[model samples]
Target: MTNYGDLVGGDRVHASLYADESVFADELDRIFTRGWVFVGHDSEVAEAGQWVTRRIGREPVIMTRDRDGSVHVLANRCSHRGTALCWEHRGRATSFQCNYHAWTFGLDGSLRAVPYPAGFEKDRVSLGLDRPAQVDSYRGFVFANLDGSAGPLAAHLGRGGVDMIDRLCDLSPTGTIHLAPNWIGHQVHSNWKMWPESDNDGYHLNWVHASMVSSAPDTYYQETVLGGETGNQSLAVDWGDGHVELDFRPSYRRELAWLGVTRERVASYCDALVAARGAEAANRSLWDGPPHGLIFPNLFLGELNLAIIEPTSASTMVHWHTAVQLDGVDEAFNRRILRQSEAAMGPAAFIVPDDAATAERMQLAVDGVQPGWASAADPRGWIDMSRGLGRERTEPDGRKAALISDETTNRGFWRQYRTVMSR
Candidate 1:
C-alpha cells in the first residue's frame, strides 16, 4: 500500500504521484469511482429519450432522460455480452438495442426485450444495466458516484462548490446556462491531475503564457492575474473540499473586463441581463463575470468555457471543453463567446497548447520518479507548493487566500487530494 500521507505533505507532494500507474489506479477507485464526479449537464439531455455518453472512473455511463422526464446514469454496455451499447457521443433513443445480440433496454435502463426471449432464463430486472448508486445535480450539472458509499452529492460539493456553480449559473440572464453538445477534445501527454492544477493555478500565467501576454497586451488577464505579485488585487483562494479558484473579482478595473468588451459592444446581452436580474445584481454579475475555478477531481469552470478533465492513464489524458452559452443571450453575443472560446481553449488555441506543452514537459522530467526521493534531504523528487505559505491569510468564511502568484490554489487541491487518497 502507498503511504499517501508521506507522499503528500503540507507544502509539497511526491512527483511519483503523477507518474505511478498504481497510484492512478487507486485514484480511479477511491476518487473517481467511489466519489462524486461531474458527468454532464441536464440541458444536454433535456427531452425524454435523449442521452449522452460519458465515463465515470473508466466505467462508461449514459446520462439519459426517461419518458417521465427523470434523469438516469446507466452503464453503457450490453447486458448480455458486455459490448458497448452506445458508441456515439449523444443521440435520441426510446430504447438502446445491442447490435450483436439484439438485447433491448428502455431509456430508463430497464431490460425491455431480448432476442429469442424463450431461451433467456436470468431475471430481466437484474440484467438491465449497471448504474452508479448515486446520481444528483446542482443547477443542471449532473454528477454520479459509481459505488453508492460516497453519501450525498451535497456533502461532496460543500459550500464552496455550490457557490462556484451558483456564481457561474447566475451570470446567465435566465439564471441558467446552456452547454452545446459539441465538446472539443484535446489529447495531452500528461497526467489528468495536471489540468485541475494548471487550470486553477494563477502563478504560471506570466511564464507559461508569456507569449499570449506579449502578443495580446491588453487582454483582461492583465488586470485580473497577469502582473507581478503586487500588480493586481486578484487572489488565489482555496475553498476547501479540494475546490480552488483564482478569484478575479477585486481586480477588474471595469465592468465586462472579462469579455474584453464594453456595454455598447454587447448591448443586447446587457439589456437582457438587466431586465432579468435588475440593475444591482446585473451590475455585480457583469463586473465579476464567471468563476475561474476547479470543482474537485474533474470539472474546470474556465470562465466563459467549461472543461472536463478525462484521464485515460497515468501518463495520458484528454481535456474536453465547450463554450458556455447564456440561455437568454442574443445569437451575436453567444457567437462572440464561441469565438473567444476558440481562441482561448481550442486545441490549437493561443492558450491551451502552451499549458499542454508545459504539462508534457513536466511529465517527461518526472517520469519514473519514486516517492523515496521526496525526503527533506533530497529535493529532487518533490514538487514544492510553498510559495505563499507564510503570507497566506484565512478569510472570515474559512477560505485560505493569497496573492495571485501564490501557491494557495495548488495547496488547496493537494490538501483535499491527500485526505481522499489516504482514505
Candidate 2:
C-alpha cells in the first residue's frame, strides 16, 4: 500500500498524485465510487416522471421523480442487451424504453416489460436492471454512492460540509435554490483536482484574476484586502472528518463597488432582496457572503450564487451562475446579476479561459511523467495558506495572513484528498 501520509504534508504534495494514470484509476474506485458524489439538485426533477441522466464516476446514472413524488436513481443501462435508457439531458417520462432492444423499466428501476414473451424463461424474470448502491439528498442537492456499505449521505458529508451547503441553500429566502437556466460547460485538459485546489488556494486570486482586479480598480479597496499586496486575508479551516470548510475573509466590497454599490447602498439592495425573498430570509442571504471551499471530491460553491465543478473526469467541468429570486424581485435586477457573474466567472469569461489554458498546459507537461508533484511550501505552517506559507492562526478555525496569496485552504483540501483517495 502506498503511504498516502507521506505523499501529503502541510506544505507540498507528491507529483505522482497528478502524473500517474494508475493513481487516477485508483482514485475513481477509492474516492469517486466509495464517496457520495453530488448528482444534481432536486428542483431539476420536481414533477412526477421528470428525469435527468448523469454520470457518477464512470457509471451512467438516471435520476427520476416517481409518481409518488419520491426520487429514484438507477443505472441508465437496459437489462436485456445493455443499452442506454435515456438519451436526453432531462425530460418527463413514465417508463424508459430501450431504443436498441424493446426492454423497458419503471421510474423506480424495476423492470416493467420486455418484448417478445417467449425469449426468456419465467424463472429468470426476477432478475432486473441493477439499482445504485445508495441514493440520498441533503437540502435539495442529490448524491449517490456505488458502494452499498458506504454510510448515509448526511453522515458522509458530516457537519462541516453540511453547514457550508446549508448556508448556501439557506441564503435563498425559500430555503431552496434552483439551478439557473443559463449555464456554461467546458472541458479542461487538466486533472480534476485542479478545480477544487484552485478554490482552496486563495493566493491565485490576485495573480490569476489580476485582470479583473485591474479592470475594476475603483470597486476594490486600495489595499487588495482579499487579493492584494498586503495580504490581509484570514482563513478558517473546519475539520469535519471526511468533509471540510475553508472560509476566506470577506473581500468582495470592491466587486460590489463595480456594481455601483456602497455602504450607503446596502439598504436598497437589502430591500430589493427582501421584497423578493422576504425580510428575514433576505437578511440571511445577504450575510452568507461568499465561500471558497469544497464539498469533498467534487463541488465548488462560491459567491454571487456561483456553483461550478466537475461531475466526471478531470477533463470536463460545468459552471453555473444562479440567483434565486423570491416571488417579487425585479426581472432586470436578476438579469444584471446573471450577466455580471457570466461576464466575470462564466466559462467564456475573461479569467476562466486563461485558467483553463494553464490547466491544459499543465496536463500536457504531466501527461506521461513517471513521477511528479506540486509544491505547497509557504512560510505559514497551517495559517499562511496563501502564496504557499505564512503562519498558523491561534484559534481553531483561524489562519492569519497578510494577503489572499496564502495557501492555507489548499493544504486543507489536499489533506482531505489524501485521506479519501488513499483509503
Candidate 3:
C-alpha cells in the first residue's frame, strides 16, 4: 500500500485515490471498518423494540432498543442462511425473524428461537443468530465495531472530538438532541470526501453560495457577520493522532434574526439554555451561527444538524441529513428550523446541489484515467488551515476574498485522509 501522507501535501492529491477500486476497498477496511462510525442518536430508538437499520462499511447493521431498554447493534444477516433480518429502514418489533428460515432473534440480538427445535441437535450452533463484535455509546450517539477487540470509542474519538460533541449537545436546554424529521437524502456521483472538503473551503461561500449571497441581506455575509463585524467566528484546525477538526466560528444571534428568528425568541432560547447550563455559561451555549463543523472521517454537524455521508462506491455516496432540536421545543419552532435548514443546507438547497454538480463533473474528468492529481494550491503552501492565505482581511470577521482558488479546508481534510489511509 502506498503512503498517501507522503504523497499528499497542501497543494496536490494523487488522483488514483479517488478513481481506483482497490484504494476504495482498502479505505473501507482500514478507516470505515475499524473506526467508531456514527450509527444514529439514542432518540431514534427511544422505545423497546424500536429499531433502525444501517450499513457500516460493507456490513449490514441493525440497531435496536431491546425490551430491557438497552441499545444493541448487530449484523442484520441471519446466521443460518445469511438472509437480511430487518427489511424495513425503521419500525417497532419484538424480534427479528428471518424470512428464509424461521430463526428469530431478540431486540438485543440474542438468539431467541428457531422454528424447528427438533431438527437441529443441542450442540449445533448453525441455527443461532450472530451478534456484532462490539456496541457502545457516548452522549446518546451509538456506534458498533465488527472487531470486538477494537479499542474504546472515546479513545478512538480523542479528547478534543468528544469535547466538541459535548458542546454541541450541551447547547440544548434539555440535554438531548432530537433529529429533525424533515430532511433530504441525495446520492452524489463522487467520493465521500468531496462533501466534507467542500464545507472546509471557506472561500467558496461568496461564490458557490452566490445565490444566498445575492439574495440574503449583505448583513449576513461571512465577513460582515463573523469576520469584521464581531470576529466571533474563527477557524481552527486541530490535527493529532489520526483524527482532525476544522472548527469554524458559529453564526451570531443577529444572523439568526435574518433567518426570521426574532431577537426576543433567540433571547428566550438563550435564557432556557442558561437555566440548564447556569447563568454564567448561557451566552456560550447558544451557538446561533453558521457553522459546518467536521469530525474527521464521515461525521459532519453543520448549521442545520447531523449530515452523514455513507460511501456506496468510489464514484457514489449516500448522504443523510438529520436535524437536531431540543426536547420541549414546540413543533412550530422545530419546523421553522427544519425549513430554514432545508432552504440553506439540504439537497435542494441553493448551495449544496451546485457542489454536488461540481463533484460529479470532477468524477467524470478522472474516471478510468490513471496517473491524475487534483491541485489544491493555496498561497499558504501545502496543508494550510489559515483563514486568509493570500487575500487581505477586509473585515474583523476574518473575511478574505471568497474565491474558488481557496482550498484551506480541503487541505485540512486531505491531511487527515492521508494520515488515516497511510496508517
Per-candidate Cα lDDT values, in order, are: 0.91, 0.62, 0.65
Instruction: Identify the candidate with maximal TM-score.
Output: 1
TM-score per candidate, chains pooled: 0.98, 0.83, 0.84
Cα-based lDDT at residue 106, candidate 2: 84
How much is 388 displaced in model 3, in angstroms?
Answer: 6.7
lDDT of 2 by residue, 296-319 (tens): 767666544445455344344444
In candidate 1, list every pair of residues with a backbone clash. none
Candidate RMSDs in Å, in order, are 1.3, 4.8, 5.2
Q: For candidate 1, lDDT tens digit of each residue in 288-358?
A: 99999999889999998999999999999999999888898888888888988998996799999999999
Total colliding residue pairs, candidate 3: 12
lDDT of 3 by residue, 112-225 (tens): 787768876664444455555667888887877666655788776665557667767776678767776544577889977777777555555555667766676443445422
Q: CA lDDT of 358 in candidate 1?
A: 97
User: What is the clash count of model 1?
Assistant: 0
Please give the clash total of every predicted structure, in order.
Answer: 0, 26, 12
